[model samples]
Target: MKMVFRWYGEGNDTVTLQQIKQIPGVEGIVWALHDVPAGEEWPMDKILDYKSKADAHGFHLEVVESVNIHEDIKLGLPSRDKYIENYKKTIEKVAKVGAKVICYNFMPVFDWIRTDLFHRLEDGSTALFYEKAKVDDMDPMELVRKISDNPDFTMPGWEPERLKHLSSLFEAYKNVTEEDLWSNLQYFLEQVIPVAEANDIKLAIHPDDPPWPIFGLPRIMTSQENLRRLLKLVDSPSNGITLCSGSLGANPRNDIVGMVREFADRIPFAHIRNVRVYENGDFIETSHRAADGTVDICGIVQAYHESGFQGYARPDHGRHIWDEQCRAGYGLYDRALGIMYLWGIWDSLERNKQEVGA
Candidate 1:
């Protein structure tokens, strides 16, 4: 695995490239222009600018967390053609800057649902938390406000420009069912997969954050069966997934280890993290240690090792520890710690493989 870190760019993020460089085994940055709205063409100069910075730090610009999908495309609206064209252009631009994979999601309204951003843990450190009951009782807009309430940094999916139309967006999606979402996603893949093939850029669709329907929005990328169907949509290596453990792990039923092995060839990017799940359907992001959380991260890595995964992987989200004044789920200290934990597992596995060969 070529380990990467998510950086929000020079001015936008609290964590600096200097700090990221200090993390052992980190090779690249998973990034994007957060200021750019979905369905818009990325500026060539800005893409180059990002590349220059990462290059200066000796970090490869191999992956982008998201090139946000246009709402019109997800809604299957008539204007989707125009946005799809923009998406094609954006893909070309990112690939020009040496990006091998672009990680994007199809979840409507929220990218990743959470009841609290800084849910306090027993250790007094806080992490992103999800409460299932809130999905039913809380107004979607209120949840938007709660997450965006922090003026310090922009939340990835809850952009004000997008959430400004939250009520109408929800209304637009009300009639759209799970099958409708599947068809729309397939339509998107059909249109863009060719462009991705031409550019040699893998378009990795991130699994739906909670892996379930949130506030009645249709979610299709929630399970292994759905992923198999997704791979069949394009039937090309360029069309792939960014398998995220925390997102899929929220639902205990997901066998992430099985997924890592089954979809091994289609996966070019991975977001590896652990979550502490509860009986009440709530979960909190935890340290990468298996005992610290419910997710079988070690087995997942072993699956990746066994499958001979050579693509990029990143330590996903981490708790805010040592009163780290950083982005909510992304703090320098804990995530750096996570990289070490994952590296420990990967290194041991690799040594075992080498010994067996010898």
Candidate 2:
């Protein structure tokens, strides 16, 4: 596996590329133009600028976390065609800059949701938490307010400009069902996959944050069967998956090892992280260590090793450790440590295989 680190650009992030390059096995950064709005074409100059920055820091710009899908495209509105064309152009731009994979999502209004940004864990470290009962009964607006109240760093999914119309976005999705979402996603894939193939950039779609519907939004990429269906929709090698462990692991039914074995060839990127699930249906993000959480991170890494996975992977959603005040889940200290943990697993596996062969 090719280890990559998620670096929010120059001033937007506290973790510098210099720090990222110091990580033992990390060779690249998973990035995107955060200031750019959805549906707008990404400028080639801006793409090249990031590429130059990564090159200057001796890292490759090989993966992008997200090129957010426009709500119009997800809603199948008439204006979707325009946005899609712009998306196609953006794909070409990213590919021109040597980015091999473009990770995006098709979730409606909110990309991901969490009840608490800093729920304190038993060990005194804080992490992103999801409270099941609270979410089921809580008002959607109240949840939005809680998530967006943090004015220090911008949350990935909860863009201020977009959430300003939360009521309208909710009303617009009143008639959109699961089937409607699937059809719209298929429509998007049909338009962009060909372009992605031509540009030699794989389009890896991230699964829903919790791998389930939230606030009545229809989430289809939540299970293995759904992923199979999504792959078949485009039926092209360029149309792929991001294979996020934390997202799919939220649903206990998802067999992540089976998914790695089944979709190994199609997966171009991965977000490997662990989460502790409670008996009451609550969950909290944890360190990448296997014993720290419910997810069998060791097994997942073993599957990737056995499969000879050569794709880009990163440690996702780290805990806020050492009193390092940074973005809720994108803190540097824990994630840098997480990368080392993953590298240790990969290194031991490789050494064991060599011993067996010898």
lDDT of each: 0.92, 0.91
Clashes of 2: 0
Residues 129-221 of candidate 2: C-alpha lDDT, one tens digit per residue: 999999899988898889878877767778888888889988999999999999999999999999998989999999998888887888898
Candidate 1 — what's its lDDT? 0.92
Query: Measured by TM-score, how close is model 2 to the native structure?
Result: 0.98
Give the per-residue lDDT digits (tens) of candidate 1, residues 159-262: 88998988889889989998888898999999999999999999999999899888878899999999999999889999899999989998899999999999
Error of 2 at 145 (Å): 1.5
What shift in Å separates residue 227 of candidate 1 from its native position after superposition? 0.4
**Candidate 1: clashing residue pairs, number:** 0
| TM-scores of all predicted structures | 0.99, 0.98
* Number of the top-ranking candidate, with lDDT as the measure: 1
Off by over 4 Å in 2: none
RMSD over all Cα atoms, model 2: 0.9
